[model samples]
Target chain A: MDFLSVLQFAFVQRAFLGGCVIAVLCAVLGLFLVLRKMSLIGDGLSHVSFGAVALGLLANMSPLYVALPLVVLASFVILKLTEKGRLYGDAAIGIVSALGIAGGVILASVSRGFNVDLFSYLFGNILSIGNEELALAVALSAVVLVVVAVFYNDLLAVTFDEEYARVSGIKTTRVNMLLMALTAVTVVLAIRVVGIMLISALLILPAATALQLARGFKGALLISALTAVTAVVAGICVSIALDLPAGGAIVAVNLVFFLAALGFKKAAV
Target chain B: MSAVISAEQLSARYNSVDVLQEISFEASAGDYIGVAGPNGAGKTTLIKALLGLVDISGGSVKLFGESLQRFGQWHKVGYLPQRASFSLLFPASVKEIVGLGLLTQKRTPKRLSSGDAALIDAALELLGIGSLRKKLIGELSGGQQQRVLLARALVARPEVLFLDEPAAALDPQIRESFFDTIRALNRDARVTVLLVTHDIGEIGQHATKLLYVDKRVVFYGKFTDFCVSTEMTDFFGTHSQHLICHQHR
Candidate 1:
């Protein structure tokens, strides 16, 4: 079947709709996270989600319900570590990431082994996404996008210089918390599209690629969003054609875009 | 005269060590006070404390008659921190950088309007950086980058401007031009300025008052009083004191 005919399947339509929304959410939040050097946040939170998912499976509960709150809490813990622990961003992320993987490993062993249901989450199964998951992704993505748009100026100010933004009466603490919370939610949502192992690529690559050529802040955001959506759509199509894992395919496509952007930047210079 | 800034028994600490101790002073409208001190003397800490950027360990600070905690009129204040504090390579344009100054004037969903755009243009022109408005901030030279930050501070037309070593990285010629622009703003625009610098001798040329501190208020008064005071003469010694006051004469 051709690509257009492939779109007629219910699962394919749901996957495209859900994947595109999550990709845009990741890209938009990624720009700020990448700029602030908090790109590892997605990876850290996803690791926490891995632990949360294991706990949920062991408890015979839905993993998404368990992972959301647990990951959000982990993000705040990371924020507090950076604030009061006198640690760098990477160090804080590293500590949380290690703890997450360890917790997940322990939980996996206690549960007698990694089950089939757990395997699906580890490597993602986007084509198996149900209507409920699709709806959840779209709604959360809209909320994240609106929050980003509403606080665009404040986010830009804080990202550029936190002290200056605070002196201007922009609530730097609140904005930082909001950014972290939004990132956590995006990471949890993106896991279904790209899996826990490759979620960071979905959160980082598009923004990095856009930064290579974008001249202005808004242009960078626009380019990043477009890059993310394009990668998701093209990756999904390629996965169906080649009978490959969708998550790996999406990340691979993003890597290709990043390499191309780097080449373009070098040539232009 | 009504005070623009008031600090009483103000103190700050870093890692449990006192950076500022019982520092008390007041700045009136249009007063140009030059803040000078040795390295690690808490000059930057004092600025940070006054602006509520750091925790106050002891007393209190008031801005525009309101206590620091209650003061919400940030548009009335401008801060140009040390150049090293900025992330210049963040892919922002000159206009975009300057537009940040006006964000305090807006509420949630803060955006630059067409009128705000006009103000940004005027600020860039005032700093002689209008041609660089479309240019990326990181691509600019050190002098130009400094100008962009100055425009960001100036765009909102703040009544009180706090500059922390703004000309530290400039060439002699550029430094003079920068000081001239500040002096003009103080003289023509009647804007209050608290300039933190290491150049005591150079600051004596334009500042109406001088505030010298090394973790405490060493001296705070007009240049004339500082020049004639036997106490300052004894503290700084005749030759060193004379070097600071020569430009005022």
Candidate 2:
């Protein structure tokens, strides 16, 4: 089957649109997360979303409806713990991540084991993304990308030297909170594309690849976004051709790009 | 001359332990005040507190006659932190780093305009770093990096500049040039300067006044007063005091 004929399917179109939006969101936010040393946050939030999904499934409701707020709350808990300066960021993320998985496991056991829907969310089923999910991804991407654009300088300032940013009157605290909130929403949106098992890879790999050869901050951001979108599109095509899992295929493609970037850096040096 | 910075009975804490206690002082326009103290003397804390970077456990701070809590004119202030505290490897160009100084003057939805770019270029040129604008920050040498940071602090042309050991990491040649630039700004542009340094003797050459601190005000007066005062001689041994005040003499 040719690539053009593959686009004939509505499910394929929806998957491409939804996956690309989520990929871009993850890529942009992932660079900041990686720079700020909060790369584990996406994994932590996805675990929380897992617990939320279990709760929603048990209650016979849509998983996303429950997962969004619950994951956001978890991300804030991590943020507050880090903000208090008592606990390290990784430790806080670890604590919340452990609790989330534990809750999800307990809920799953209580509900008599994992069903097909739970399994799909565990590894993702991008080809099964509905029109509603696609619309949500596009709308959320628009809002998130715009916010990132508007606050790009502030974010750079806050991430680089928070003390300098504060004295410069950039309102460091507000920008930090805004970043956390945006990451929460993006993590939730990304779950549909990469699922709970590999969400962090989606959030981190593209940025890591970009940083391997990027000349400056803006270049890194642009390269990361492009890498992520390309990975998603190529992953979808490969998944369709080989009848493989889209999430795994996407992560595999990202790994390839990261290796290529590493090779490129070495050759340049 | 009107005071550009004033603090009354200001106190600050770190980990619930007092670092600055009832620190009171005033800096008039164009006043070059050198803040000197031993390690752990809270000189850095005082600078942070004045800028509202650290929480004030007590007292009040005023900048440009506006209370710290109500002061909204941030473009009027600049701060250059200790070089050791900065992250050098962050992915930013020198131009982008200096451009941040202009963000303080922008409102929400802040966007850099062509005018802002011009200002950044001017600041780079002022610091002799115009050629390094496109260079990555981490790729620059220590001296070049310091110049970039200084340009950032000076880019907005702030009325008051706070520098905490700004040249502690530079070579003697670079350090002299850096101090010369700061002194020129204070004398020529009339920008108020509060410089925190460990080298009291070195600072005495440029600063008009001295504010010695060790968790509290040890002394606050003109270089001439500090040089001739019997009390300062008593607090610091005559030999030590003379060593610090020799440049003033």
Candidate 3:
């Protein structure tokens, strides 16, 4: 097919649209994740999502719906464990992620063979976006973005100083819970494009790249979203031209963006 | 004058270990109370108790004649914790950081009111860093950062300000200037101040009310009274009393 004709395919159009929406969601939500130094929490939760997806594939159910509530529950558990268990963040993430990956392995072994659906979740297939998935991703992105915008100042306060935020009556607990909940939801949405395994990197990469290039918090956020969108579109184009898988290609593009950002930062300094 | 804050027989426990016990004190509006104690003396605990942060296992705290439990006017209170830690890599400018004090007082999704913006500007000017508003918060020196943090707390135009070990790691010159600024705030703005610190000597000149705590109220009254009362030497030792004579900015 010609270059223009490839873009005309219905599945290709859906992939690009869904990719854009989910990129915005991941970049925006990931800004705080990277800033607060909880990037691995994303990694841990996404692994938990891997097990949940495994469960769905085994039961002949839609992995997306199944992974949704399960991932949300895991997010709460991770938060409570880190706060009260005397264990550090990495420890908590490690324990939960180990449980998730092992469980997935055990389940897959029992099932005797990995199905096409299960394999899709591991590496992801951007060309498989259905209309419903696209709609859900767009709606959830809007919701997450609204929460970020509305609680921007409060989030900044809690992120900067939890004690001061608490004394200042910022409802820190609620704000934090909201952020965790939004992250869990956004992680699930991002999995369709980046896969459960590499989803956290998708969430964090854009934010880190933006931090290298932008001077202000607001500037970083805006630039991160722009970078994510550009990378998603460019990744899709490269994937089409090279006849490669879009998800892996998108991550490749993200790495390139990160390296370029580092160069620009050094040059500016 | 009526008391703005009254803690009666107050107590606090951490991990079932008693940190403060049956402590009581009162301060009226415009009072500059310096909270002094040795390490692990429950000085921070006492501040936390008044701020309604620590659990009040016994007694009560009253703010503006209302019990702390029922007191919903948290917006009028400002707090700066010990060690003022924040990421130097964070992209927040000085303006954004200071604006958070007032922003936390506001409801979500609300824009800064014109009055709030004015207060922020005034606070920056008050702390003598209005020109540095555009600078990254992490780029400033420790003392400058302290002033910026002070400006943050001041932006709320708080009726009662609580500072915990604010000058802990600052240079001697900066520490003196920090207290000087506090004195000015107390003298000019009528903002009631509660400074929790270990430097008994440095804070002596600035404080109107002195609260000497060691898990209990060792002495609570005028700074002059604490210096003269035998309880001062008893609680702090003869050296503290002798040092009091030479303690001045």
Candidate 4:
């Protein structure tokens, strides 16, 4: 199909708009993640989100609704476990992530007839987005954006120095929990656009790339959003043309941009 | 004057190791107290404990007459952590770094108001880096970065300021200037200061009171008393030698 024809389809329009919104939210949150050295948590949580989706499907419920609360609960568990020193930081993430993906694989195996649907979720099918999903994605992203804006200063202070933030009365614990909760929600919403396996790359790479060029917290947010937007648009166009998976293509584009940014930084130095 | 900070028999552990044991001290308002110890003597741990950043295994801490558990009163405290080098290319200006100090205060959603801007400018100017306000923090020299951090700590107009080795990496001239700046802040602003340092001689010269620690309190008294104490000589001899050996290797 021609590019214009693809744009004319309601499903395609929904996917495009949904991808844009998810891209912006993920990229902005990713800046804080990379700064806090929690990039791996993004990957781990995305896997958990996949398991939540599978569980929702198996229970015969709307996967999005079920996945939403499930992933948030799991993220809270991860945060709590780490804070309580029940597990070493990275090990906690790894253990939870492994269990999540394994559970998803087992669940999918039992539901044999939904293999194609599962595959689409694993690798993403942008053309499969519906109006309801689009609206939900837009609303969630807007909410995340508003929260970040309102608490931008607190977030920045906590990200840079937790001790200082606490001393300044910023309630670092509350802010951290809220950030993780938002991350889980964003991951669940992003599954339709970027899929489970590659969602973290979309969330992390654009922010990492933008950090190389942006100045402060505000600049980083703007640059990361723009970079994510560019990656999504280009990846969508290329994937559609080549009949390839959109999620993997988008991640590849992000990786390319990250490498280019590093090269640019090195050459400048 | 009321004590701004008081810790009695404070102890902390890391995993299975005892990092600090039976450490006790008190800082009254307008007191310039210097904490002197060899490496691993729990100087940093003490500061962290005071800030309620680390958990205490024993004893109690009070800040501004409130228990450390009641950290809602943290607004009265400020801290300057040791120089943690950032990537030289990290894209944040000095103004932004100092601006982060003001993040604890109530602020509007948009740009900072003129009054907030004035406060930031005053902090930068006080630290003698007004011209470097717009420059990237990563681009500054070691002394300049320390100054920026000090400025960040002072921006809050705190009642108590905790500085961790503020002159650890600076040159002699810069170190003197840094101490002068701190002394001025204590004198002019009447801000109570608790400084962590390894420079025993400098501490003796500048601090009103000296606290000597080596995983415990060896001594806590006036600087003159510390200078005359035999315990100071013994602790610095073995402890200081160990630190020098570690630094050389």
Q: Whose lDDT is greatest here? A: 1
Per-residue C-alpha lDDT of model 4 across residues B37-131, encoded as one tens digit per residue = 87989899999888888999999998887888875655467788875534454567888888777766664452456787788899989878999
- What would the per-residue lDDT of candidate 2 be over residues A23-91, giving only the tens digit for each residue? 999999999999888999999989988889999999998888888889888888998999885899999
Where is model 2 more than 4 Å wrong at Cα?
A: A1-4, B84-87
lDDT of 1 at A123: 84
In candidate 4, what are the lDDT values of residues A1-269, reduced to their tens digit? 57778878777677778888999998999888887778888889888877877888888888889889878888888888888957865787887898889988899999876666677788777778888888888898999999988887787777776777787777788988989898999888888888888888977898899877776667878888988988888888888888788888888888888899889878987
Q: Chain A: TM-score in each candidate?
A: 0.98, 0.97, 0.96, 0.95
* Rank order (by TM-score, best first): 1, 2, 3, 4
Cand. 3: chain B TM-score: 0.91
TM-score of each: 0.98, 0.97, 0.94, 0.92
Model 1, A114-139: lDDT tens digits are 56777788888789899988988899
For candidate 2, give the DockQ.
0.62
Task: For residue B155, give model 2's deviation from the true position in Å.
Answer: 0.4
Model 3, range A1-269, lDDT digits (tens) per residue? 78899999999999999999889888887888787788887788889888888888888788889988988888888788877787887898898888888888788878866566677898888898898898888888888888889888888888887777777777777887787899899888888897877888788889989988776778888989998999899999999999998998898899899999999989988
Candidate that would win on TM-score: 1
Candidate 3 error regions (>4 Å): B54-59, B245-249
Q: What share of the reference contacts is kept in model 3?
A: 0.56
- Each model's DockQ score: 0.79, 0.62, 0.61, 0.43
TM-score of chain B of 4: 0.88
